[model samples]
Target: MNILTAMSSRLTVPFLDLKSQYRQHQAAFDGAMGAVIAEAAFAGGPWVERFEAEFAAYCGTTYAVGVANGTVALWMVLLAMGIGPGDEVITVPSSFIATAEAISFCGAKPVFVDIQEADCNMDPGLLKAAISSRTKAIIPVHLFGHPANMEAILAIAQEHGLPVVEDAAQAHGARYDGKMAGSMGLAGCFSFHPVKNLGAFGEAGAVITNDGELAQKLQRLRDHGQFEKYQHEVIGWNGRMDGLQAAVLSTKLPFLEERNAQRRQRAGWYFEQLGGIPDLVLPASLPEVEHAWHQFPVRIPCRDAVFAAMQGAGIGCSIHYPVPIHRQKAYHFLGLPEGSFPVAERCSREFLSLPIFPELTEEQVRTVTRVLKLWITRNHRVKNIAFSGKLAV
Candidate 1:
């Protein structure tokens, strides 16, 4: 290929850098994999057990049960809470579909709530209005690694006698009032998908809790209802995490704090560089909360045009969810029409997530922020200025 072609090929940046990550822990990861393989304990074995224990400790929880993936971890938590048929799980619609899907899997309805405008998390102010006798639990997803207003949510949950299941999939180390994301709820679910802060080689997840009985129930729920082999007591699904994935996770676990710190640092750089860019709204941090920086998402006007320009510029910008869960075809049966969730729908159309990973260098962060600012200002500045003038009139 010519230099031009090579340059064009190199222009595209990945949203996450698995290569740099593996390179950083090549020897340890390889050794952990080798150990798991040599032990021939591939399923629900010693390695997985060790990983779960370590992860629970990391999350500051008493128990952690490894599952096949984030979705299963969520489902298991709801099920173990005895939440099923004729129940409703209240959650925000701005998050990944898995948050609602897990509730639906248990024959429960998902009550969509609006998010706080700045953080794109479930707005605590909207919680009370959504509560009903059918509301068995509240699942607040720490969207984009910013911890939700858990203090308010917990107070509401306590008042309503609702169990709180945290979707901590995007927030591994985020803190609210000094309490870790997972540790704030009755149970918290985490995803070890490759893009997450503590991502594994493949799919892995865990359900964490301080409640011993709830933890035991979730363990059985993940292991085909058998605490011991052939002693199945309840109908359960085989959602155990793979030994290989657990081994990889164990190898990477110690680096999670450092990785999250780097992500925060990169986000700070983006904030500093992109803070004053017209038409671009950066993510916000509350005075009492610390965001894990899972994704440095921002909302901007002319989102579609800005997205196109970024893609054309060979930048790796993407939307977390361009469509809200209420608008998804699978949930159409719920009968929520367009604009039913105005805030979430608006968020879907306007929010964009720039590339964020600990492996991203300062140069890459600057490049992404620079491209985004240039695109938005170039395309929309005239209209925005005109609108401002009109508002003055």
Candidate 2:
């Protein structure tokens, strides 16, 4: 019997255990939901307003507008900023498609840029060349809870007279140079999907901004552009966040900091255990930034084989993205070829997201590392033996 087969019977770890998180604060969640039910505020009402205020304060922003989901959060921000046909938005291709989709949906072109090899975030050096005469805005995504190089990105934006909207979907409490991820830009967008750090029971999202006029415009844009009942001021969509999701998010917000700390702790354990592996490349963090550790993705040789081996050992592993957005069929019109963004394309092929969550225990982490190490060791030995055989022949 192999190491993987033997370990499979003794241990099993999931990528995320939301049920355990729910059980940790069941009463608070239930009571909050019950209150919303009692008031019958099923749509946008007091609960949604309460969460918006609390979230804004937490992000150190003057205002936050609740919306249906993170995609729409980005979409709404672009719309409110007057981004439309003939405009262009600059962002990296090493992110979820939603980042670029939001721009495409707004009738603007998404100009792709490569990311830094070390941190897998946007490379500020490349940002300047991508800006064109039609460039209207910049959307810097805080990918995998690691804040991007905002100081440099912002300086360039200011020089070009452009607005920046932070994509903080996976970086709820991440900080950069003592500033919150979403607070540094003109407006920051967030998502409250069940898997996020501060998630609701279902889809929810918000935009935080220091500009009050922008806040009011977002509020109107989310609700049919209504200035008053039966009074439509501008064309809009049904993007309002439901009251139930808002209540659930509010209940989960207070505990987000604690959970983020736990995630960091888990990340440290991964570094301590896997750092010495010669062929493994661990995730990198920038100086003066606090990473939220949303996903601990590491690059390794023979990633597909190792991933399958880990699965056989009862460990839940995933790939954040196996394909870059530029290569996707949906974006074929962009005319970007295979090597447009080499770093992102390489990462998409080799990156593996191991099991990581607040509820994951130290022992579980140990099991995961052990399985990975065993696979690497065995694969190396087999390759060496084959090389020797070839020499003898």
lDDT of all predictions: 0.86, 0.91
For each candidate, give its TM-score against the true structure: 0.94, 0.96
Tens digits of per-residue lDDT for model 2 on 153-196?
Answer: 99999999999999999999999998999999999999999988
**Model 1 agreement with the true structure over 59-144: per-residue lDDT tens digits:** 88989989999999999899888888999999998899999999999999999999988678899999999999899999999989
After superposition, the stretches of candidate 2 with alpha carbons farther than 4 Å from their true spots are 384-393
Best by TM-score: 2
**Model 2 Cα RMSD, 1 decimal:** 3.0
In angstroms, the error of model 1 at 345 is 1.0
Clashes of 1: 0
- Give residue 113's error in model 1 in angstroms: 0.9
Off by over 4 Å in 1: 1-10, 381-393
